[model samples]
Target chain A: MPTLSIAELKKQANLIRQDIILMLERAGSGHPSGALGMADIFAVLYFQILNHTPHKPNSPLRDRLILSCGHYCPVLYATLARAGYFPLVELKTLRQINSRLQGHPHNLSLPGVENSSGPLGQGISQAVGMALAGKIDQAKHQIFCITSDAEHNEGQLWEAIMTANKYQLNNLINIVDCNNIQIDGKTTDIMPLLSLRKKYESFGWKVLEMNGHNYGNIIATIKQAKNYQKGPVVILAHTIPGKGVSFMENKYDWHGKAPNKEQAEKALQELRQAV
Target chain B: MPKENKNKSTRDGFGDALLALAKKDKNIVVVSADLAESTRVWKFAKKYPARFIEVGVAEQNMLGIAAGLALADKIPIATSFAVFSPGRNWDQLRISVCYSKANVKIIGSHTGLGAGEDGASHQALEDIAITRCLPNLVVLAPADYNEAQKALAVAIKHQGPIYLRLTRQNTPIFTSAKSIFKIGQANILQKGQDVTLIACGALVYDALQVAKKLATQNISVEVINCHTIKPLDKKTILASVKKTKKVVTLEDHQIHGGLGSAVAELLAENYPVPVKIMGVNDTFGESGTPEKLYKKYGLDQEHIIKNIKEII
Candidate 1:
């Protein structure tokens, strides 16, 4: 696959944002803020960063990506479809009964989805396991786990952090979508996870902070992460809860609630204009 | 009558079997949660250091790691106390292992009253209930040391998520090496027409003894060792209950969701025989010797005999 330029990647991210709005509107219920916020990161991963094949989703040499905060699966489904893992038209069937696109990401139902996740604080530990396996097998494929800032409230997330550090899993790259909004309320108000960079650094992770929506920064950060050979690297991508759409941006109400037809039309109009 | 030999802990059997399997299949990996000595995973750790993962008291991480390894086409056996694995890290086991349909084996040691002297917090009376209820998880509580070893082999051979409930105390080894061991298959130790004695885990030996003692009194008892609690052997149980007309279920777990519950549910749905469920009666177990605990918890041969006599 040829490398996608930063402008092209940003355009893809905008398209993914549009898909997120449309899918959430069609489903009548889904997380929109986190999905929209994670578009640029997913675009960078599926389009340029990840060493994966859309056709051979189970190829041994392909890099593994785990979605820890599975509530934000619209971003993943839209991105995976856009990357040709499946038909983009199937994106409309999100959260429908018997659809491969479950409310939470199901690995068995979809190809390319490495781990099924819905509950918080589980994806990182699984990534640690995969990275450990990679180390044992001497496999070249890296393991990437995408988690949320709010899920850091869970004790299990810290346990996985300690594990990844103890194992010195340099092949693992954890991307934290620091959207700062959870279902209940703001992350700091709900449960203080301030000083995340320092926290990860103290946990022996190579911490990298960047503007999550900036395609160039995301690409650079991922490249820098791939170079670190000391321990596991965590890219704390600071993201707005909703990026492209103005009304939903930085609003916690859109954290879980889906847009109606008018709201989705507005969001899509804004995204299309941005593109 | 089956002679009472030297007692052996089922966890030891699991350890030995794990080591044996790891020796043959390099793909077999053991993940421990700082209970290597208690869970008997130290043997495999000592043998194959590379294949053994010491997650250091993190049961949740241990299970998640096992799921990850399973995803990578490696057979990962995660070992910890029953309470910690199914009790504390249940969500991980449910979502990561079972929901994902990962080929991971969960060895939950120190289950039931066999976790002697550790008190209620340590004992896992609700393991079978929690694990068996999960979709795509095979729950097995072996009869004795010999059966536990065979169960480990079978769990290793089988794919998907499995929870092998093991005991801490040295219970009597009733099943021999030659005993037929199959997943979801029950063993009929002895057959009788008067009443049926269905049991699992360490209590199987006690059930056998209860049968022999009852036989002397002209009360012929049929004994079935139900090692595999989930995907239960309905055929053997139904067939045995058909002959006996009366049924008594026994286990080392809570009566609500253990072998007794499985048997009761099976019989109630299919045969509808008069059943007497024998197990820990929905109460916390305090610190005590395994023998004293079993007796006090109404899981001994005496209790089984008492229940049998009352039902008959």
Candidate 2:
């Protein structure tokens, strides 16, 4: 597969960020911090990394992506549309009564969504099961799970972490969005996670740390993590909440709050000027 | 003529059927949270080592993994004690499997006082109540070994989330191979008009025993095995009750939310009949022998017979 160049990927990520701001503004209620923080990773995953056929979303041979933190579904919806899974016009009906784009990711309602998730800490475990199935069947498809840093507060996350290493799931790659801002305050203030690198290392996982906002860094780090044969690989990607929007950047207020028309305009303007 | 009574735990029947189901369907995988032998899934784990996944002492993760495997087109049978799967990981079952519409078969073994000396924490008296409330989740408590085997076959073919609640104790296997089994359909073992005896799980056999004792006293009784708890067999239940006008509902679960409450709920709205709900009455079980626990908890045959006399 010919990879998207870093310039092209950056443009895609910018376009994705714009869509996130637009859809969240239109929806009137959604999470912005993690969605904006994960735009670059989503772009790299769909365009440059994932072995998926967007046309045939349920193709048995395609790779699977399980979104653990579902409140940030705007990022997943935007990325799927950008990847040709659905039309971009459908993005306007997000959070509407009859729209397929649910407030939380519902796999049965939409195509290309591997599993339904909204409640945190379950997606990682689901990815383990999918990865374990691939290993048992000797399938080549990989399973990637995306989670928020604050969602680690759930005890089930540690349960999942233990199961992944215990089974030595080589086909599973976890991408953690370490934006450091949760709903109410900073993660350190709410609940000090201390060092995630040491935590994963001690769990017998191959830990890869990289800058999530950088397109080149995302591509390089994910490529390395996928090829990792030791055991389960968890990539702790450092990022800023609400990246590119100066007002929202690093602010925990935007973690679960959607932008109004004025804020959306400013965020879109910044994204358009950069790419 | 009565069917042969095979003494076997419902958990063993579940394990035996799973082994056979896995043979035909290659996608059938067993996911356990370190209760393989106790839950009777050790056979499947031993026979199909590659197909079995043991997530040690992690019920929440076990459910998530089962939901994930179902997404990948694998029919995952997640096994654990009733207190854990629907007990500890109900949210996972609700959000991951039930709400997601994943094809996950959850076997909650050692239900009711079948957990025996494991005490209150291990007993899953509230499992049916919790699982029955979840949308798109089918709940089953097969009576004996044969019904358990047949119920699993029915659950596997349903293609959605189904909770098969099993017990640890050996009960009388009255249902034969030829006995008809269908989801949401109850089979009336005997016909009478004095009163109706509706039971599920380990208490189904005891209900039959009490029905026989009531017969010699000239008090006619009708016995119905309500194995499928969620989609109550309203047709069969109402038909029996309309003739009798008095009902005695029995289960190993608390009288609040198990089979008894379900029957009372159905009858109260449709046809207000005087129903006596016999089981654990608004309390928890303790550590004791299965027989003593049943007797003390008002689930034994004598208590059931007494309850029937009061209702009549």
> Per-residue CA lDDT of candidate 2, range B218-299, in tens?
9999999899998989999999999999999888888778888899999999999899988787888989888989888878
lDDT of 1 by residue, A43-104 (tens): 99998988988999999999999999999899999999999999999999999998999999
Pull out the clashing pairs in model 1. none
User: What are the candidates' individual DockQ scores?
Assistant: 0.87, 0.86
lDDT of 1 at A55: 94
Error of 1 at B118 (Å): 1.4
Residue lDDT tens for model 1, B1-312: 355568898998898888888888989998889989888988788888988888888899889989999999999999889999978999999899999999999988888987999999999999999988899999888888888889999998998899999999887776787777999888899989899988888888888888889889999999998888889999998988888899999888898977788888888789997999988998999999989998898888788888999999
List the candidates' TM-scores in order: 0.99, 0.98
Candidate 2 per-residue lDDT over residues A26-132, each given as its tens digit: 99999988898898899889988999988899888988999999998999999999899899999988899999999999988888888888888999999998998
Q: Pick the candidate with the highest TM-score.
A: 1
Ten contiguous residues minimizing lDDT sum, candidate 2 chain A: A1-10
